[model samples]
Target: MDSRSVSSRLRELVKFLGTVQGDLSNVTGPPSLLAPSSVVEVGHAWAQRPAVFAAPALESDPEKRSLLVLRWFLTSLRSQLYVNGAPGVSIKKPLNAFLGELFFASWTDEEHKATTQLVAEQVSHHPPITAMHIADREHGIRADGYARVEMTFNGAVNIRQVGHAMVHIDRYDEDHLVPLPDVKIRGFLGGCMYPEITGTYQIMSSAGFVTEIYFSGEGMISGKRNSFQARIYRREDTKRREPLYEATGIWSKGWTVKDVRTGDVLEVYDVEAPENAPMPIDIAPLDEQDEWESRRAWAGVLAGMASGDMRIVLAEKTKIEQAQRQLRAQEAAEGRKWEPLLFRSQEGEDHAVFHELTEGTGWRLFNERTKGVWKVDESKVVGAQSPYRGELTPLG
Candidate 1:
């Protein structure tokens, strides 16, 4: 374009941004910030720390493997909450994902000759359930899970995760069920909102070991942010329950795990350490990606978000939503039910394993809540391309 036109566009962009900020300034209640990402991409954060996610598969001892799993889970919280690239102390709300929205990514560890592939899909839209599957073929480790997020306003944005992830180690024939924690977004009125992991959750394993983590938010008087205490124990020892290992620290920063009997530190995970940084995820180029791919599907919205143009952002978002409504209407009119191409309802032996892992806990697979017990249909996931290639829908 000519210089005059370019200058005019820049001026308009600045003016629009100022106007947005001005509108926020006049708000009388808690204001929400627009995050520069979509919720579908948030599922990718679980596998960002690929090294941690894959470590459990390499360990032989079931106890040590359980500890490694706990470490991996705690380390992923920062990435999950800050996926928008915002400062640690600032978290904004992301765009809700449309049903069937898919994301594909992989992390390659050349030194270890390991590749961890991740696939995330928005399986349910009414309650917003995101299903994720991460597989490390080289290590025989596979994780499949879904997150059903329920957001409510109680002075702050309180979120309760109503789903669990199951990690299976093919070598040991073991399964680990990891429950999710609740979250509270504080400081909205102050204009800087941040997420705090709250409440308690547990990880139950088929190998007879379990780990429970308790999260404590910063108190008004004295306490640290992201602080937590976790205990690993044997499942059978309920009466004289003595923890095998304990972990304590701020999850957003770092934590140390120690042997309960000897008090010897086993491992330390530092969130900010250079060696502990999350591996970058590799995604296909937008042109090479399928129409249903997360980045390709939301290209326009992403561009608007990147350029800080709320007008374009809202318009693109509304267009997609309207298209989705139309597609649902068509399905109802034709008496055809829409099904996920990559994931299917959990059946057969999968049900038994899930039941065993969550036998005594409150983390049962809520098939009804998530629409269905979703699992990756490995047969359908052939390659980097999306499984679906028919007519374009809302996601496309």
Candidate 2:
């Protein structure tokens, strides 16, 4: 593009950004100098000012990794700034999301507080945020090998569009996050790798054998694992959501989805339990620094990133199954053995272990063996393999 065209576009883009800023979701009421000041001040305190990523740096031979580093910096900068610029005094985003159902150490809500009266209930009710930064890269496509790419998902169809990942490194100011043993973010997003899978359905009715409502879409998400299969289905005259549940291996537990008009849970085909329960990761809790209210933030980013990927894999497992079926058809024509997702390969008679993982099996591993047979849901065993994929991890 010519310089004149470029300048014209920049002018237009800037105006568009300003217009959208006036109306965005979860946004602070209005723009005030003071509102942004708090966020900017804290943001500036960080060791380095975030550099907005540019394609030049990302695609450049000498600065590819640097571009990624800058990518993290810029995205983290926005979240930090936004949190610090949250609506009330002390520019921090409210602690409510992080607190869940537990009464905060300095909780302001009386009814919201968790008294010593109900410990077990509180524990079951609250699950940590896992990841907090709003500018999450996990939901987007990975900048694979510095290819310098940007991907989008409609999330109206395939939930496998969600991706699971571990933000091996997370640094947004002094509150540095360097997992001692390394941590992975685990969660899900309504993103996708393919948009063709995104499909929406209307609640016309479900009164007979055709009592099923399915809306499929694709999304690119990261939490637990990278990518997922997004599915919103109505089964037995009920609507239940399993975003990225088909092809991906991750499963969302105890999540409640309610209709906006009249809070009703969708009862799609019941998603069964899995074989293994997720292994617990050691988590450090808030202490003295927490009560100080000095930017009361919880680092659940890692957990969400880890689990999101797990969910993505589970969703993607559906695709894997379809591919396997195709492979089987060919094999049958040629007379060969079909490779099941969670089958075993043995080098010798005494050494036999599980091999591939079906989509359901992947869900078992992602959820860490929570659903499967009697105690486990049979659906989870539909297909599965071992849960070990040589993923690249971060260094200490």
Candidate 3:
């Protein structure tokens, strides 16, 4: 937490960035810059607590549940934007996920008495895509998605997230399509690297409802940081002139939901409170996880980082990267492509799936890409069970 240590960490990260730049210049594929821990560890940073997905499970009404889902999604942005623990905090770079690396965790919602499980896998390395699946069988809710980032550096770092997520509630037989927002990393050269999320995203439900969200940062003359506004509309209404619900607030702080027609405030989200605190995810014991599992694979590197020994960190990190490179080379020699373990990709048919899910609703999939839509393997899910209990372990 000391400024000197923070500065030192930033310097180290910048040095790693230089290596990445050089590697890219040489036309190598994505450079591996694994921090002292696993990329799976970085994933935990996104949802420091687990309750984000639990909100929908707690809601019984389809329409109200959709609103809760949107709120949960917005709340997650707080942690996602401040990955280095908090604003202005300089932390080590996140570990780059290796192909096929798996991360599994689960959390129990004490209030709802439901268990939520999350399964994430690094499905692709060249484009660095991660596939994730979350399920709460008790509440008949599930979500599946994939994430990939395209980054560009021009004074400030701009990151465009390319992915879509689908949340399904069996009770309502509704599917919610969620898109990610763009991110900007500010003050890189000034030595205060922090993330600023910007741009518009949408959440469309199969129940003829659509929520349009706009993200913005503090302006010189007006606007506060992490400001966002969302309007929900019923798709069947052709004019789209009136919204059913509206929400406005600073994402990091909280927000208020209002019934637009009645002009009555419905709910307020106070994210900082202990009752609304993030649910803790339980990870399987390191020894029980497979060698390809995130925790076990990066155990040495994590230990090195905890001990503040960069020598050990680098050695372990290099070993993992080298092994990955060798595996790729061997696969190429054998004329084989690495296949994902838990997700299946469908090319040119993502829009079809979107249509199927949002059939009755007027909402259409926007910004649909051809990188192929990735879906969880239901067969695998049917057989797999949560590996951990309610007790959460330190990520390191």
Instruction: Give me the candidate number with maximum lDDT.
Output: 1
Evaluated against the true structure, the overall lDDT of model 1 is 0.76
Off by over 4 Å in 2: 1-63, 81-89, 93-95, 98-127, 131-140, 143-396
Model 1: per-residue lDDT, tens digit, 1-396?
A: 465644554454334434443212111121124565667777566787667778898898999999988987887788787645434445556767777888889988676667789888888776677888899887899899887887655456567777778899999999998877888877544445578888888888889998989999788898898899999999999566689999999888889889999989987877888988778779998998877777887888788878878678778777887888888888789998767768877643457888877776656566667676778888778743543656665643
Candidate 2 structure quality by residue, lDDT tens digits, 339-385: 21111222322211111111112211112111111011123224322
TM-score (C-alpha, index-matched) for candidate 1: 0.88
**In candidate 3, where is summed lDDT lowest over 10 consecutive residues?**
22-31
TM-score (all chains, Cα) for each model:
0.88, 0.17, 0.84
lDDT of each: 0.76, 0.22, 0.68
TM-score winner: 1
- Clash count list over all predictions: 0, 126, 1
Candidate 3 overall Cα lDDT vs. reference? 0.68
Q: Which runs of model 1 end up more than 4 angstroms from their true locations?
A: 1-32, 85-88, 347-350, 383-387
Sorted on lDDT, best first, the list reads 1, 3, 2
